[model samples]
Target: MSDDNGLPGAQTRRALLAGAGAVGAAVVLAACGGDEDPAGPGSAAPTAPDGSGEPGAADVVVRAADVPVGGGVILASKGVVVTQPTAGVFKGFSPICTHQRCPVSAVDGGTINCTCHNSRFSIEDGSVRSGPATQPLPAKEIVVDGDRISLA
Candidate 1:
């Protein structure tokens, strides 16, 4: 007994429902597709287009004096890490970890630590300091003009 589009046997109601479900699932997955950076401006950080938290070309990342001499600050909204490895030297790197592209959560003990899988990178050059991540965080160009740190 063939069904409407008839081939061999009649389609069961359950089978029809399952086929419909599969199509729905495919549509849902397609809607979610992308390799877009999850840390882009608003993951765990606040964002604004009115020149607030979001990093703009002219936005000051942080006051130079605000970052510690041997530590760094994670600017999640800016998607960058500003590190003062030495008193007068500053470095900037993408906040995203090389391990799984998770954002690094802290800068401590001369390392940028990603809480995702405990991967650490150098605060000095963004080099990998530990494993699970063989690559280093990519350098992010930043300008430190006197007392302000901004993306370059």
Candidate 2:
């Protein structure tokens, strides 16, 4: 038995409707695709914008005083970790763990720890102190001018 389009029976009509619905769902998903969210600013870090409005130049991730000697702070919003391995020396590195890209949650006992996979990194230079991450966290360039720590 033929319907208006000559496709077989009620079963065929049901299949056609289901297929169309699936296609519509796929289109919706494609429209929303991207590495960043479209709803708002992708990062909360404050940045100094050029007149053209493209930001991230000379952004201050944290105050020099905020990072403690022999410890670090995870700035998840900026994907950087600021550490003060000594009284006056400051360092920065990518906070995302080398193993699975999970952000390191804490700087404790002279190591940065990724809660996701138990990867440990040295606070002094972002080197891996233990596995399951064999690679070290990559360095992030920053300039320390007096009391401020800004991305370079």
Clashes of 1: 0
Candidate whose lDDT is highest: 1
Estimate the overall C-alpha local distance difference test score of candidate 1.
0.86
- Candidate 2 stretches with Cα past 4 Å from truth are 1-58
Q: Write the per-residue lDDT of candidate 2 for residues 1-152, one digit (tens) a residue.
A: 34555655867788899999999999999998996745567655443543223343446678788998999889988878999999989888998999998888999998999999999999888899999999999999988877678778
Q: Model 1, which residues run further than 4 Å from truth?
A: 1-58
> For every candidate structure, what is the RMSD over all alpha carbons to the true structure, in angstroms?
9.9, 8.4
Give the 10-residue window scoring lowest on summed lDDT in candidate 1.
Answer: 48-57
The per-model lDDT (C-alpha) reads 0.86, 0.84
Which residue window of length 10 is worst by lDDT in model 2? Answer: 47-56
